[model samples]
Target: MKIAIVVKEHIETKGGLERYAVTLSRGLTARGHEVHVYANRWDVDESLIFHYVPCVKWLNLLKVITFPANARKHLAKSSFDLVYSLTPLYPVDIYRVGEGIHADVLRARFPNPLKRFLKRLTPKHRSILAIEKRLFTKGNYRAIITNSKLVKERLNQVYDVPFQDIEVIYNGYDDKLFNTNTRAYRGNLRDTYGIGDKEKVLLFASNDFKRKGLVYLLEAIAFLNRRDIRVRLMVVGKGKTAQYKRIAERLGILSQVIFAGAVTDIERY
Candidate 1:
């Protein structure tokens, strides 16, 4: 069967939804489907024959609502049997990978003002969410894929959609890269950063710190330090770096915190 996957870049790596898009496309291709990915013009994957979407973030939020005009046009132009949409905050059909729907996990990790507001207002906050909800629940999909059971259950409850619609598929870590044999790679990474073997390494990885409870983690680390746990935090990610640095400075733990920005390599983790 021919397949079309719609996705967008959420980060260089680590966005579960983005990973799902790439993963699903590759998997389907392996099974002999003619797969095509539809994404923002900025996204590049020559190997996968990625089609650039007409709409992108720079134009404005208004474009977000109306500019998918091109995507709709593109879909009508295709005769693919299946379309799997890896949600980049837009709606698509047949297969989807819903993310972070566990209320407990959301509460623990993303207790931020904006996230809180979005959760409460949901479809009311943006027309996109409502569009997504309507398409997902009402679409003619042979199967839907979700990353987690919690998310699958939440999708059913939220939209009152059939529970059988979603199939659970997980995001994978590269076992080859993360194996014990990767010590050489890890050592090289550590040496590049001049990180000492004796320093208590508090490795925090996230694209957004505020949403991931970086402040709470820092505070908890400070509390741990009073008990003589001299820790050094390596924050590997993209957004709000300056805000986190300021918070560290205010806590007088600036020396202990190292904002590593974004780095590539499985060993770096």
Candidate 2:
């Protein structure tokens, strides 16, 4: 079977969605399917065929729009038994919306009515919403896959996509990289970071630190500092850690907060 996987970023990119695409493509290839990946910018993998979609780098919105547009055009020129899109692309056999609905995020995160209204009015936000609506409504995708029940509910609540049409498919990770076998590295990792054996370690890992509530985590660590129990937080993943570092400093838990940055090997800690 010939299959095409569509995503904005390269499968080799370090993120939940990228990992999913890589894993899915590898799995499909192992099962005797020829997999082709379509992306705007990608880290190359020899096992799968890659089709690049040209887009302007400066205009973020244009970049988002161009990838799908080019990918669709490419798809029209080519033929595949199955077209699976991780993004909200039109006319795909399957749409896997691992990234939750942007509408829901806007509404939940920004409680201020004025802010929400203004944010919705933005070009990027409007474009995302429009594409999502089309993907759910007129695209006629055979199936809509979500990473969690919350995502499924969000789809139903936001776009009125039928609950029956949304299938909850959880993300997969490297089990070997996140297993009990990594226990040996725990002490070494802690010691290397100057963490005492008695100190409790809290791990917060996310590429987008702000969205993942890094500030909230630091505040929690602050409150926990008041207690007799010693606690330390190891922050992993990419983002401007300087702001979070200031936050930790302000909370007087700077020593306790270790900004580990983006780590490829997660299970080691």
In terms of lDDT, the best-performing candidate is 2
Against the reference, the lDDT scores of all candidates come to 0.66, 0.83
Local accuracy of candidate 2 as per-residue lDDT tens digits, 1-269: 99999987864448778778888888898898999999876777788899887777788788668777888899898899999998778999999987578877786667699999999998988998888788889456888898899988878887888888889977777885678899899889978899888878899988877666788888887787688656889988888989889888999999888989887776687
> Which residues of candidate 2, in runs, are more than 4 Å off?
none
State model 2's lDDT: 0.83
Q: What is the lDDT of residue 176 in candidate 2?
A: 58
Span of ten consecutive residues with least summed lDDT in model 2 = 10-19
What TM-scores do the predictions have? 0.80, 0.93
Return the top candidate by TM-score: 2
